[model samples]
Each structure stands twice: as structure tokens, then as C-alpha cells.
Target: MPASAFDDLDSYIALPRVEALALSPDGRRAVLTVAALRKDATGYERSLWEVPADGSGGPRRLTRSAKGEAGAAFTAGGDVLFVSARPDGDDAPEAGQLWLLPAAGGEARPVTRLAGGVSSLAAVAEASASVIVSADLLPAATTLEDEAVLRKKRKDKKVSAILHDAYPVRHWDHDLGPADPHLLALDLSALDDTIAAAVADEAAEDAEATMDASTPYPSSLPRPRDLTPAPRRSADVEGAALTPDGATLFAGMRRSLPRGSRSILVAIDVASGERAVLFDEDGVDFGEPVVSHDGQTLAFVRRDRGSAERPFDAAVWVCALDGSGARRVAADWDRWPTQLVFDADDTALIATADQDGRGPVFRLPLDGAPVLQLTDDHYAYSHVGVDRARGGYVALRSSWVESPHPVRIDADGAVTPLATPAPVPSTTAKLTEVETEASDGTRIRGWLVLPEGADAATPAPLLLWIHGGPFASWNAWSWRWAPLLAAARGYAVLLPDPGLSTGYGLEFVARGWNAWGREPYTDLMAIADAVVARDDIDADKTAAMGGSFGGYMANWVAGHTDRFRAIVTHASLWALDQFGPTTDDSEFWSRIFTAEGMASHSPHHSVAEIRTPMLVIHGDKDYRVPIGEGLRLWSELAEHHADDDGRLPHRFLYFPDENHWILSPQHTVIWYQTVFAFLDEHVHGREFVRPELLG
Candidate 1:
């Protein structure tokens, strides 16, 4: 048997990871973006690999550079288009630039050299070589040349400030920006002509052998046409698709309001650069646009804004390209679809949604028939790309037992995994399902991971792992919070999806909507009670831990009960009234929570009741849950529990440079180290051994 990666943090972090998949138009090949830990072990670098869609051959590396590449899309000619910050000649782009890997198989060449490098491939025409990419452009610049000059001036003057006239000045981790994103269109023929001229000039010089990296491509390339000009701050393109002929583009554009913004679908003429609103309504936002094979129909997701009384609802909607004949798909279905793509036959649409603790693929017909599930498994599927010609699909599937990898799904729901360089890591832990009934008679279920020798004779310590999102499920695998690591330390971890978790019907979410401390709290306690009753779990030795909304629940659990020996909260919501207006997006938070509801559920009111030791972790750069929350939490803990000598049983781990999540490689290792140490001290009655790096 193979060794479990959880045995060693270094070995676990060194494992190769795969993300994102792009299938060719003919469904012959797939390009996967795989990230491997760098040689220095400071970060991970991504590379493109070609995998045979038929599963006949092994994966082959396509591109290699220090800067790495991602966001791959296939053009009509089978060429792979990706964005990378790799150097061309002596100049390294400040941002990622669009690069093309030719179908004929030579060397990847740069396509666009803009002041703000291309960010992502927006849309690719099926019948034409034209492509659209999203890039950031200064609002003051009218042309690409003008933008270049303005950027140079700013760099020379060392001006790092941005004047915002909008509601949200910052997002989750970073500032919103000095430049807004715009969609740019490029004609491949013009680029081809320019490349031909450069090659001819090099031949005329008769210096092919001497053609170093400095002069491989021409200095003057055809500039891309800016499809969106003067978009200001409202140009956040959420999703986009192009017509078969590349003559029209349908995109979800964010419309800025006095306090916030809402997304609306728009159609832009490819040639004339004219845009018209295709769908816009009050109190609703639309995104994830997809066009059919024939380009006559459009599909997108419509989200009805939520209120204090009820949570928001998302529905699949389809209409013509001209914005007529709009109707909801599968109106009777309770599942909320997250992805949409037209199948080969175009008679039905293929989509994916969370269901029964897993996100499975489904086929919904245009005639409003019953929705049919395409995949029946324990894995959650994402990045679904439909095979237009063969009526098949390619996607990335993952579960609690395995990491994400590329797979091909047939029309009959058969799945064949494509070759990947990363092999699934083994673990000594075992997974099993546990369910119980809440006080309200609602069924609550979760996954329990047990260490290798756990039994009635030697019951393992328990860890109640509450998932964040309060709206997310515990179906998918997560590197950040892998339960196997705890199992490797002879601990059992329980992952419970309580109320407000998706996949469950809307009614289940509503049970905890206005009353966060009610159903969600009771559901978690109910599931934990059932698990602790098992002979293989130690009922007296347990702890509760969570982050974000989960963190809120952990605090609530601490104040309401004394069952758990310890608690861990990360980026938590300590005070409802202070948090509502201080978060990154106040409008969305305020709309969903009323003053009365917040007061009734606020965890800060119970601070005086908390008796369990706690570990509070937060990032200073986290704008979503500001650092003030952690500071307030630490202060309250001291004021309530500290002795005359100012000593308390609580600890606060702060990261000044990290965002909401600990992203750096070293920092992530420290995060796990501190968490394990804290748990050992409180739950296992072991001495509190502080991590060496913290000192």
C-alpha cells in the first residue's frame, strides 16, 4: 500500500494539482492547466498539457516557461490560446498577455501586446478565427496607444493611488483598481499576416541561425479592436459567448448603482462595436451566458435578489439572441444550476448543480420535460465543456477521496478519465456517512473520517468540522482543510452540512435564513450528538472549528454550549451591527439581514457565556471580514477571562500580508501547524506546543 500524503506536510504540498480544462472543437484533444510546486518550494507554477480526449494515449507537456500559463481556450483552427506573463525578447510583460500555441506544433507566439495584458479568453467563434479577450484599460484612454502612454507616465511618477467614485472601493483582498476590465476583439488573419511579414524579413536577412530571442517576432503587430470603450467601473464582464460566425457577442455586464451593482446580459455587434441590452430587470442579476451551436438561442442564469424575509433564488433561463421568447428551464426542478452548455444535438442543455451532497451533471430538455441526471457518483463536477460534434462532455470531477482530474463523459453517463501527471494520493483514513434527525424533524447528514485503528476499544477523539459558506456543502475535496491530516494524527473528523447548505432544497436553506443561530446551530449539534454516540468516537473529547460563516457558528456554539473542549474561528463575524456596514460589500450584506434579525442572532451578545478555550485566526488584509472583527473578538475574550496578571486561555494568529485565505506556501503550513497544536492542547489534554515559526 502507498503511504498517506497526510503523514508529511511537505510531501502533501509537493503533490501535483490539476485545474481547468479546455476541449477542442472537434473533441479530439483537451488542454489541462496543471500546477506544480516550484523548485524553490515557495509557490506553484502552472503549465499547459495536451491530453488525448479518447484516453488512448498519455498526457504530453505543451508549454514551459518561468511565468507559467493558464485560461486556455481552443480556436476554430485547433490552436490553443492561453494567457501568460512569459518574456518575449528582453521585455517581460507586467501582466499576462495572450499567447497562441499553433496547431502545426512549433513554438507558442505572442498575439497581443497591450499596456494592460489580456486577462482571459472571453469567447471564441466556431466558424471563424476571430477571438475575444477581456483586458483592463484606463478609463481616460481612448485608444491602446494612449493607454500605453498614460501607463508610462504613471510608472514614472510613482503614483499608486486610485480615485473611486463608486460604492465598493476594495474587494475580497485587493483594491478594485486604477483600470477597469474591457473586452477586446482580434482578427487572427491580421496577426497571421504580421507574423508572415516578420518571418519573411528574417529570411531576407538570411540569419535564421542568428535569430535569437531578441528578434523572433516583429515589433509592430496589428492592434486589437476595443469592443468596449470608456466602460468606467461597470465593465465587469462575468460571462460571455460568441456567435458561430463571430459576428455577435453576448456578455453579462455589471451595471453600477448608487450603492451597489447588478449584472445584465448585453449583445455587442462584432464589427461595429455597438452594444444593446438583451436582458435587464429590477431586483435581479443575470450571468453565466452560453450560446447554442447554431447561435440563435442564448442561455444564462437569473438570480432574484434576496430580502430579510427570504434567501435569493437562482434559475436557468433561455431566450433568443435578440432577447425574445425568454422562459425558465426546468421550472419545477428544485436544484440550482451553476453551469450551462448546449449539447451536440441542441435539443437539450447540459448543466451541473449541487444535489444530495454532490454536484452532478444533468440534462434539461427545451420542451420542459423532467430533468435527467447524467452522472450518479460521489464526485462534484466542474469546468464542463460540451462536445458539440460527438454529443459527449469533458469535465473535472473530484470527491473527498481524490483531487480533481480531467474526465470524459459519454451521452449514456459513462465516465472515462483522461491521462494526468498527478496520481491520486492514498490515505489510511476511512470515510462513512452519518445522519440524524433535528429537533424539528429535519434530516441532517455528514461525512465522518476515521483514523486507521479506530474502534470501540480505542475510540478516537472527535472534531466537528463546520463548513464555511454556511451555504456550501461538504461534498468536494479541499486542500486547505483536508480531514485526512487530522486522521493521520489519530483523530476522527466529522464534516456536516447543516441548514443553509446548498444541494438541499430552498426550504432547508430558509430554515436558517432569518435565524442563523437557530436551525444551523441545532442541525450541527444534532449531527454531532449522533456522531458522538458512535462507539468509535470519544464523546468527552471533541472540538468545534470553522471559518467565515462557519466561524460565526463556532462562536455561537461556544456561547450556547459547553460540550466542546475547544473552538477555532477564522475571519469570523463577531458583531452583526458593526460587521454589516464595515464589510467589503455592505449593500449585499445589509439587504439580506435586518436589524431585528441581526440582533437576535448576533454571537457577540453571548461573549460573556463562553467558557471554552479558543484559537482565533485572521488575516489583516481580509476586507471581506475586516481585521477589526478579530481584534474585537480578542479584546472581548481578554476582558471576560483574563486574570489580574492579564493571562487568558485564548490565542490570536494574525497574518499581516495574507488575504482572507492563507495563500503562501509557508504560511499555509504554519496555519495547519498552529491549528493542530491548539487542538492537541485543549482536546487531548497535551501541553500547548507553540509552532517554531511563530516564535
Candidate 2:
């Protein structure tokens, strides 16, 4: 909490950030998954462990993911189902295969592969039966019907500190080939006895397969009548709910397309072609709807505007079958309600709330009653589930400080811990905080991490690192490994949470409105100046680096100042004019920053001003900040173009497989290594990039 706290990355993160919790329909079992960091062969392995739901049982291992996974569910028969990356799949496949493990502990079975990738999975029961879901494999191709892949390249862009936000549109990217994602529906009946789903058959090796455009849910049971004659893709459906007789199916779709219209909720008789639009939110969204046991009421998460990381403050609203008598049962304005559950008797609503510090599971009555806590002292009590048939609740819990560990509560209220905690390398650096005044005289807060073994007797090189989310802040608790590696190499790190930082107050962050590359950049320089004044930091040898919004800032700084010896940009957008029109939030950027001003700050248009030696990393398939931006910047530098100062040297590293995020442990390590090498070469006077590492 000081200007020198960056001296070392804290070894352990704070704990008890948990999913408040979730229960099963039978109320027999529960699962608790905890997020913990552990070292594997490469480095830290963030994973999920499991345990009983009610309050008893030894912890179990559910997922051994590296970056970790979310959204774990329970099958009717009490099997645990969830999504995660698979080694057998492409690198960063991200299809999120549906994995199943018996509630009592057994080998995880891949029901089926999600070809495009299963973004979501919902379970339902019929006639007191159970269904086993092999896998709702995403279709390898959505439309082979025409014998031609209707490929359309969609380009979207944005700026990030490290260019770490979006992936470019690439032909052979991870999402290419038979991986055209279409929303598919799969229903594992009561106890998972009978299965039904909307599937796309990819059996045609050389030809396109035609869809019936009818009942989509593939099932071992008889084909349900086509409620939707047009049979739109599952991607069009946001949520699904089954009736008591398993006869009716309800679905929701995103409505912000074409012209941003109202979202529609429709009902389809699974057994007959009876379909109807129950309701529509003119300018809002109501999705992830679940039907009450009585089949007369519907509940869903409703809000206004999505896709731009909108604050997910949705309330649980229930309405009659006709879409009338709508009333909000529970709402959380501050935090997103990750999960919602209704007791079998339909008398109580168990909701997962993360409003304050962390999430905690709570049980509330449907009629009306103060919410009651079900679990205490947990951080991210999320990835929660209930295997009522298995007799407990299960969840994956994660902490902001330490690696996540899965914990569960059994029928009798006993808690069990699972998985070993992860180990992070000891930080040779110190972590501290500093406050400075921006050019506009606005107060800005920052986290300054001094290099290890550097003090008044020895000044260390400095790396002014920025965070993405002009709205996101770097506070006491945040995860950024790049600076740690730099510190390990004897360079100081400075992370400043300028105006528009969350957690402080809504008003503080508002100061950053339309102020990109201006005050925010000023804050960065101020923090650098303040830190370098200390005997422990060397100003002349300082460097700059960041991803996404941070990436954009890096581009901006490299173009305007010769202060940095070297700079690295990742998944960044360089041209604001290009980004303004393509971004999903184009209107938003225009409304807040004005379209013209945003274009003026873009680095692409001002490339002639760049002077620093720079490295740019772009994921080939990044849709958020696409690789084109990287290519643009790289090409400009390759042209040997002289800036206002002089000639600039640059290198562009393109990750063909990665998306908006870097997922491979090996790639992550290499990426950090490159960052430190660049800093060390310029800041510490050591050739940073390894010649052998580059191909």
C-alpha cells in the first residue's frame, strides 16, 4: 500500500472471495469449486476443486484448468457438467467441451464436443426420468446446406493498454474450419435419463449438410414437432426452459442487431409446432430465463445494453405465462448475480450475489423475506451447483490474492477442501502506492512497485505500465505478471489507477470521460516522474508497456514522447477512426469522447511521431482489437519511416492461434519473457529478446 510495495509481488492473494452458493432441485447435494494457484511443469496452474454442497464431504478435483473455467452445472442424475479447454483439441480451442463426472466421483466423460464451442448448457427433466448427455458438440459447420461456406469477414477494433482485448479476423484462426459456432440446445431429461437437443450434423466430410429447420434439440426420444418452421440457429436463442411435461420450450435471443430492436421471448411446444412470442422488452434485455416448477411463471435476467462489458446488474424478474403481472423478485444494482436457483417447491430463491468485497451464497423466500446467508467467508462463491440427486451443493471458489481452491458443504453442514494451493515465484520487488495530480489538477492513485535490490545506493530502470479499461483501475489487489518479471530483471514497475477507476466511487472514474491520451497519459507521466525522483528508480532508462487499453496508451506514448527507451504493445488498436466505426460501442465512443476527437488521438494517423524501439504482439484472430492494427503499426515502422525525433525500430509478433486472451501456459511464459527481455535490453542494457526464441 505504499509507493514501494511493488518491491515484491505479494506471494499470496487474499481469500474467501466465493460464490454466495447454489443448490439443486432435489436439495440432496451441492458442489463448491474453489480457484487456487498451483505450480505445474511450466508455472502457476489456476484450477478448480470440488466438494459436497450441503456442508459435508471431502473435496474433489473437477477441473485442472490452467487459467481456470467458470459456469459449472448439475445434471438431473447428479452428474457434474462444466466447460473447459481440452488438450486433445486445438490450442485455445475454447469450444468449452461439456464434461461429466458422477457426483460420487468417477472419470470425467466427454459427452460430446462442442464444434463451434458450447457457450452454455442447460438441463431439464421429463416424466421423472434421467438423460445422459454425451456432448452438445458445437457443429463443425453451421451451413453445409448450400455446399458453400458463406464466410463473411467481420472486423471490430478497440484500444487497450497492452493490446490484450480483441482478436483479429483470420481465415484459418481457431474459430475457422468446421468451427462455425451456432447455438445448439441439449436437454438431459429428469435424472438425465432421456436426452434432447438441437444439433447440427457435421458428418459430411466433402459436402454441406442441409438443416431441416425444424425441431432442433437432438434427442433419443421421438422428434418433437417443429415449433419454429424457420428453425433459426441456436445462437439466436439466449436461454431455454422446458415445461412440466417436457412439451414446451421457451427461448430468448439478442435483439441489438441490424437496428437495435427489442428482445423477444418465445414459447414453442416441443411436441407440436405451437410457437408464440410471450413478451418483448422494447429497449432492454431479458435473457437466461428459467421456468418455475409450476410451469406458470418465468424468471430471467433483464437489463439495458450489453456486449461492451456493461455492468451486469440484473434482477430476478418473474412473470405470468402471458408475460403479464411482471414483478422484480430480487435485484442487485452494484454487482452481477452470477447464478439464480429456485427451490423445487418454488417457495425460495437461492441467488449468488457479489456486491461488496466478494460473493457469498444466500437463500431468500420467493414470497418475501430478508436474504439469509448460506456460506460465509468466501471469495467468488461462484462456479456453484447443486446435484440434488447427489445430496449436496458444489462450487468453484476463487480468491483475488491466492490461487483458487474448491470447497463444498455437505447435507449436515460440514465443509471440505480440495486441491493443493498454487505457488507463485517469490517477488524480489516491493509493492507500494502513490498519489499524484494530473495536468488538470485531478488526483490520481497508483501502485508503484520498486525493483528488487534497488534503492538509494542503486537506481533501477523503470517501466511505466498502464492498465486497460479506461474504466478499470489497478488497486491494492490486481493481477499483472509482466511487471513482476521486469522487476525480477531489476526494473521498477508503476501501475497507476487514474481517473475513472472503479471501487473508489462512480464520480472519480467519470473524470476520464473522453480524456484518452490526454489526462490519463498525463497521470502516467506524473507517476513516472514521482517514482523516478526516488533514488531507487532511474528515469532515463525507464520503459513503457501494457495490453489492450494499455496497448493503446503505449501506442499513444510511443508516438508523442521520446521518454521511453523501449515499448511493447499487445492486442492494441492504433487507429481510433478505424475503431470508432467498427467497434460494437462505436456509438458509445462517439457519445462520450466524440467521434472526431477519438480519431485525432489514434496512433495510426500519427505514426510519423513515434521514436521509441517498440514490440507489438497481436493475436491472429483477435476480434476485440484485431491483428490488422498490429500489421498497420508494424508495416509503418518497417517502412523505415522517420518520426519527429528520428528513425524507429519495431518488431511485430503475431500469435496465429490465440484470441483476445493468451491462454497457453507456454505462450504466456514466452510472452512475459519477451516483455522482460525488451525492457532489460533497453532499461538494463542487456539484449532483451532471445535470438533463439524468435523463429
lDDT of 1 by residue, 331-368 (tens): 98887887898888777899998888898999999988
After best superposition, candidate 1 residue 312: deviation in angstroms? Answer: 0.5
Per-candidate local distance difference test:
0.87, 0.56
Each prediction's number of clashing residue pairs: 0, 136
Give the C-alpha lDDT of model 2: 0.56
Best by TM-score: 1
TM-score of each: 0.95, 0.66
Q: In candidate 1, which residue pairs clash? A: none
TM-score, cand. 1 vs. native: 0.95
What value of lDDT does candidate 1 attain over all alpha carbons? Answer: 0.87
